[model samples]
Structures are given as structure tokens and as C-alpha cells.
Target: MANYYIVGLSTIIGLTILSLLYDSFDMDMYNCGSTLRNLVVTAPHDTTREFSSKNVTFDIAGKQWKDVIVLVHIQKTGGSNFGRHLKANLMLEKPCVCQRGSKVCNCSRLGSEKEQWLFSEHSVGWACGLHADWTEMINCVPSMLDKFENARQKRRYFYVTMLREPFARFLSEWQHVKRGATWFSSLHMCDGHVPTKKELPLCYKDASWAGVSLDEFLSCPFNLATNRQTRMLADLTKVGCYSSLSDAETKVKMLESAKENLRRFAFFGLTENQVDTQLLFEDTFKLKFMEDFIQRNDTNAASIKQEDLTVEQIQRIYDVNAEDFLLYDYARDLFKERVSAMRARRKRRIPS
Candidate 1:
């Protein structure tokens, strides 16, 4: 980040007031502040890995690389932490999230991506809260595969994302947007984060007081209008949720299952697993800096208004986030399977 240093003239606190007054939209609030003009001159990604006493080179574009893996930040799943970490770690070009029409596209500016890879010194780690479209995996993968094969000699990038339990995410969303008069979080008009990560709990909370719930809404067929409804649900299943937290039988099973799910994340370096952040960075990225980079609380502080939810309210959350539930569950299973495979490989090397 030498090329991307803070212009420490004066006006340190001066900038803070300007940002608050403007109510800026920033993906990485801590590091980049409110500046959208992210600049870093990357010159040839040349990094070697030492895994198991082996030295391997990281190739990209024409040198060492694969498709840029971006984490679509859905509201509060460690978005600021993730964005700052990504920019600080990865060498990305002009990564931009274009909001065209209703869909939000998280991508690098055209042409400049190649320049960043060709001339830049490290890998470009692009991340943002601009909502992720995994279907991009369907289209973008094909276009990038050929280039990736030549550079990194790989056809895929490690598309990584961390998710939270749906109901929790929903509660958080509802509480967060309720106080603000922002129209984006309104019922008729929704923004990027709502559809991708959190559920439309603003209307739910308001509606629930009037006996309206997502379960009632989701009872409708998941069509284009309801697609966001289902997608919102998909993120919750990663942590598992059912109708009642009062279900002693199901609660015990789910709590244990959640722990099991988190246990495997150690293999992926995902913080959602409650693994040591340093272990996560060192293991996955194969590098370490600012070992104590952040205090343990990746999410917001306790004093912040949280989405106060009843156990029954959770099912409404699940119903809304159903789509994210599918995606989260699929990814979670894949993550677990990969962890198993890694363990098996280690076992094989254990002198058997």
C-alpha cells in the first residue's frame, strides 16, 4: 500500500466531519475512508509460495493470476473488515461496482484490469459491499478461464465469501435501516445489499407489528418479483434455522450443527468459523501482516442498535433470505467437503 498512502498533510479530523456530513457511501470505511478513487500501480504479480517445503510461483494475466475473486459484501458480514483486508492484501486494478439498472455489478473497470495485472507488482484484491452476483460465475468464468490458464495455469479463482445466519442478518438489517429515512431500504424500492445479503426486514418489522411476516410473503411463488425473497433466505441456512428456537430438540441439534459448520472453516480461513483471524490469513492467503490487525469483534459494537428479534421472528428471516440460504448452504457444504479432502490428504502423508 506504499503507492496508496494517506496524504497526511493536516485536516485529519477535518476529513471526518466532511465524511459524516456528506453521509458517504464507502465500501472500506476504515482504510479507504470515503474516497472511491482507489489507486495503486501494480507491476507484474510476482510472488512465490512455500508450501510443504516446496517453492511455487504465482503466475497471472501473462505472468501469474486467475479471475479476480471478489467478495460481495451483504450488509454487515464483516464488510469493512473484508474490504480493507482485501485492498491491503491483494493487488487489484481499478475495481469498481457498477449499479446499472436494478442489478449491481462488482467488477474492475474494463481495460484497466489488464494493465493492473500486467504492470502491477502484486495481486489485486478487490472487494466491496456492492452486492455479489454468483451467476457472474457462470458468465465471467468462461471469459477468464483462457487467460487464467495461461497465467496461473488454473481455470478458476478461489471465489470466497463469508456468510451469517439469515435471521441474524435480517434482524441486523431491520434495525439498521429503520431509524434512517433512506428510500433504498424501503419496501417498494430496495437496494443491492438487501436482495443479496440481508432480508427486507424493514417492512417486516413494520409489517409484523401489523401481523405481516416474510413467511406470509414467501408463501407466494418465487417468481422474478419474489426472487429476491428466496435469495435473501439462502444465506441463513449456512448457520441453519428452523421455525422455533424454543424447540429444545431442534435447538440443540442446530447449535451443535452450527459449531460443526464453523469448525471446518478453519480450513478455508473464514472468520465466520470463529477461528483465529491470523490463522485464517496465514493459511488461506499464505501471508501474514498486522497479526493483531483487528480486535475480535468483526461485526459492530454492542451499543449499536441491533435487530431485536423474537425466536419466531427468525423463521420470517429464513423465509426472506431463502435464496441466499441455497447459495450459502451449497458453499458451506463445498467448504466442508474441501476441508475433509485436505484432511484426508494430510492423513495419507502421515506415514500410512
Candidate 2:
């Protein structure tokens, strides 16, 4: 975030004009007292724990997982790179719904259409992997484990996901949509925040953020800018779409559940630590990704420099993604612990 900046040179009246132009800005409408403050909320009581204490690492001695891996692909979190690696190293079965000559792959079915195809009728007897729909498959273990044929295969169902710093991800997503990324065109086609007609899809209607500036967009009630990682990790059925207004107990339970689920994952990686992430994959799955493989997508969307965002935008982003920040911290600690444990185990291999 050191490189990130906000262009915070606007006057109070300037902000007013920007808000009026966007039609949804209300940062000035808040009823705070004279002395403005930025309060940092502490993580939940249960947010901290010894990562090494969790028994989440899988035993791959027989490499039963060599054929089956499930990835929960979080957008803009180096998913393209990860998918590229998978395509290059592993023999993927083409999706059932996606025809052989189709130029566009529709993954709109519960956001796991690709994963659905992986387990669909057409994908049997293939050594491949699936990009899971996190929302539809929040109970990561059982949802993926059930896909395996038997107990032996179930033991090999590897689940992995990568997380990013929330603000960076949100900024990337905004820029991606702003630039009209081909993949996100479904939701990015609309020209404004609200659709003029009644027929637009919910995503497009809600995310028609075209005319709004970054600060203006951040000020609005943007769903994707919220604790997205937490939402994806959360068992939404159990907790039911948490918000700042949700009861305290409910949010705590959701956070606790998400952390527990992360522990249950075969491997949890970070976009900031892509090398380590790939190393974990190679070490766990026993496959080498080629050095020359194009892992990242080419994008002209410039990153939002931290200094370029207003104080309000920065605070808004932080406040909105508070849950994700905590989750990312926990995941970082877990990743380090798991990597250290792997190295220690390697040192004690006792060559036969």
C-alpha cells in the first residue's frame, strides 16, 4: 500500500459538486460532531489463535490428490495466473456447457459454472481440477469432498484459495470494470450507477458504476467493495448476508466460521506472496509450473495509489473491509506456519 495514494486536493464544495454529479454520494451527509475522527475497530475476540495449532494440513504421501484439486477463484486475486498454471501443467477436461469452439465461457451459473462442468456428466474419468463457486459452495470441505468417488478419493480432494488485501482488490475490480474487461462485460455494460429501465440484471443494475469517480464509488453502498473475502468464505446460509447492521453475535460467528474453514483448506495462499503460493502448490500437488507460463492478465487499469485516495475514501474502504482485513491477517499467519512446517518436515525426511 506504500505505493497507493489518493488525490486528496478537493475542497468541501468540490466534493459537493462531485457528489451531485454522481447522484449517490453522501459522505457529507453523515451526522458526526465537529471533531471528525477515524476510529479503528479491534478484531473480534476470537480472531487471534496459534496457526500451527490447527490440524488442517493434508497428508499426500500416495499423491491421491494428483488428479483432483478445487480452487475457489476470487476475482482479481491472481486467479488468471493460477488458472493459466493449471491449464499448462494439468490436462483439463473442457467444460460441458462450454462448446469446443465457443469463444466465451459462461461461468454465470452460481459463479461456479466452470466447476459445475468439472463435476458434470461430461467430465467423468478425467484427471483435472475445478474452479469452485465460493458462494454456492461455502462449506468447502463437504461440497468438494462429496464429488470424489469414495473415501480414498475424498481424502484427495484438495481445496485451495488465494486472498488479497481488500482495498487493492476493490481498486483493481473498479479499474477492471472501468476499462471494460471482456470477462466482466456482463456487469460493466451499464452507463451509470442505477439502470433507467426495470429489466437489467441485478449485477448490472447494482454495479452500473461507470460515471462515478473512485472516491464517489467508494462512498456509495457498493456490495463488492464490502468484506468480499469474508462473504465468500462465510457460510451465508448459516449467517445470512452480514452487514454493519447485523447483530454482533452473528458477525462474530461468521468470522469464526470463515477462519475455521480456512484452516480446513488444503492450502491457503496470498496474492502478495505468489511465489510462495506457487511453491506450496508444487510441493503439495507435486507438479511444476513452467517458468515461461503467462500467469497474469494484461491490463491497462492503473492501480489506485494509496496517497491518491481521499481520507474519507481510505477510511470507507477500511471500515467496509474490516472483516476481510482480519481474515487476511489470520490467513497470512497460517500460510507462514504451514510453509515453515513443510520445510521442517522436509528437513526430517529420513531418506530411504
TM-score of each: 0.42, 0.59
TM-score of 1: 0.42
lDDT of 1 by residue, 1-352 (tens): 0110122212223333333453333322212311211211121221112222212222223233442333433454555565555545443434334344522233332443332221111122221112433322223333343453333333223334455544344444444444342233222212222333232223333433233243443343321222232232122332232223223333233333332223222222334553444444444544445424454543433333324434444444444344334334444565555455446645787984
- In Å, residue 34's CA in model 2 sits off its true spot by 58
lDDT (tens digit, per residue) of candidate 2 on 185-215: 3221111222223332223444454654666
- Residue 310 of model 1 has an lDDT of 43
Runs with alpha carbons beyond 4 Å of true place in candidate 2: 2-67, 90-135, 138-156, 180-207, 241-249, 292-302, 350-352
**Each model's RMSD to truth, in Å?**
18.0, 13.7
